[model samples]
Target: MSRPRRLLTLGHSYVVGTNRRLARAMAQAGAGEWEVTAAAPAAFPGDLGPITLQPEAGERVVPVSVHGAGRIHTMRYGPELRDLLRQEWDVVHCWEEPFIVSGAQVAAWTPRGAKLVFATFQNLPKRYPPPFSWMERYTMRRADGWIAFGRLVAEVLGARGIYDRRPHRVIAPGVDTTLFRPDRDAGARIRSSLGWMDDAAPVVGYLGRFVPEKGIETLMAALDGCAQPWRALFVGGGPLEAEVRAWAGRYGDRVRIVTGVAHDAVPDFVNAMDLLCAPSRTTRRWHEQLGRMLTEAMACGVPVAGSDSGEIPFVIGDAGLVIPENDVAAWTREIDALLASPQRRADLASRGRARAEAEFALDVVARQHLDFFDNLLMETR
Candidate 1:
């Protein structure tokens, strides 16, 4: 039998076990065909607090010290990474932005025989300043291929000509179906805890950062204008927390704003919702890359409604409703329509779950990545 290919993946996000699902899934999916090792930081600063590396069973994970721990642009791996890179690898996959210092370091140290691929979520084209631009140039020059987190990301990077003549694929992020699938009992428990046991109103949820660009105001307005009875749950913390709390105060028990919910407990909150809304508004420099919440909700068999901003429409596709980013009236109308018809909600939930399984499930995404890597290795040989 031929020897299995060695695959090494490195990323800061892997410090969290949930974010390491891709690597774990790949290892499982490619068993007997490939050997996968994931490298993550021992500790990194998180939004809520310091996050220690949480490795999962059945996956080969190595915890390495990271300099400038929380800072993506400036962070660099410790000497252990240098030794790891010196080892033989068939593929080196970097889950960092190509314009960052860590990315350049990876590109520079990757063995010449190995195919190095970088994954990115930057959906906008911008002329990055000084060292970042230099770093991007060096990394791209060395990269054997690249992966875009969304269609818009591929389009933007392709148009920039940064990846001209290089191979790239549009691979969306994955969701753990086992962790996110429908759970009515869990939903009931959450509702009961929220003092909403008697309320039959459909729950409208927003599950990302509570920032202005997320269109929190638009969601609040839509809730106000919703002709049908509804409950609201905003899960997450950000600069707009105080404002969200103040707004939720008006509805008393009808609305709940939950901050600091850990990633592992997010499924409970998602299950509590009848529908999830991602009303992201685009700004000059930033727009939604891919609303991972959409996939998670879909995986949970929850109907989703999102704005047409950036990749939301692409991510949602035909599985759920898509409203204009800033159209409060349209948002109100569509949300009302969904809430009014359980049939529509059920249909969307069914379609969304199917979509999640077909496209965004962990194993499905892992297979896609392995295929890409196989093709790259074949072409190079």
Candidate 2:
């Protein structure tokens, strides 16, 4: 009798819940051939506990601290991650852009006979300082396979002269279709909860960090230009929360700012929105990676409007509106147009839902990941 192939996935983003979704999906797909263990932060983002998505019997979540997203210094994880790497395994997967040194540490511990697969969401190539650059190079060289969220990520790598013979797959991180699908009644329920009863006014949503790179100021400026009736929903927390609150406050009873909603509640927020905006702008430090909210809103059959930053256009793919990055005038025009045209909005909604189902469904990408891992293992054998 042969032992099951062991798969270990390490990430700090597991707190966001999507990582756990992928972990669970992978566990199900690899049932006969593999055993999967996921290692993530003991405390989820916002100091939340373990995810609502409980592990199946025998599958496990090894709680550990994985920090260092914004800090210039390298991240730190517990010793369990280090000791576990010494054991034999078929695959060690690290789901962080190599720019972060923690990924390098994970790759460095890859067992002699095991394969190291690293996933990256960095659409823009970054030039790092000495030790970090060296560590990033080390991790890239060690990877047996690369999974990127978009084609531009590979272009960024190629432009930086980072090359390897190993296979690479451009796969969007999957969204749970069951959790984020369209519901005809969800909008009414959500709107009513927000005291927006019987209001037929257009609702635009922004569901990410209140950070500058998100271009929230531009969104606010565009909304300020609106002459027609429109409501805005802001659903996240970050450094600029105060500014965001003030912006929402100007709208008085029309705007809703929701913080600390569970992952499961995200769909309801999306449903309440007539349009979802991901108006990210490219800065030297960051660009929109996947515009995950765009896809989530799409899954909920809500039309989206994104800026021409990073992979937003690629992800949208004609399903929704794509305006010039940081162009408030363009955002204003598009928002007004979409709000007035019900048929056009419906058309976009239908197309966006189709695109999400086809391109970003959890099971579809999970199978792609399983296939990629299987092929890499086969090649090594």
lDDT of 1 by residue, 113-173 (tens): 9999999999988888989999999999999999999999999899866696689999999
lDDT of 2 by residue, 1-381 (tens): 888888888787775555688888888888888888888766543443344333445557776765554452476665778888888889888887676667877877777688888898777656779888888788788888888888788777656645445578888988888999998688789888889874668898999988999988898999999877888988887888899888778779888888888778899889989899999989887878899999899999999999999989999998999999988999999998898888999999999999999999988888888888889988866
Candidate 1 residue 215 C-alpha distance from true site, Å: 0.9
Candidate closest to the true structure, highest lDDT: 1
Instruction: Name the lDDT of candidate 2.
Output: 0.83
TM-score of candidate 2 on Cα atoms, chains taken together: 0.91
The parts of candidate 1 lying over 4 Å away from their true place are none
Q: What is the lDDT of residue 5 in candidate 2?
A: 88
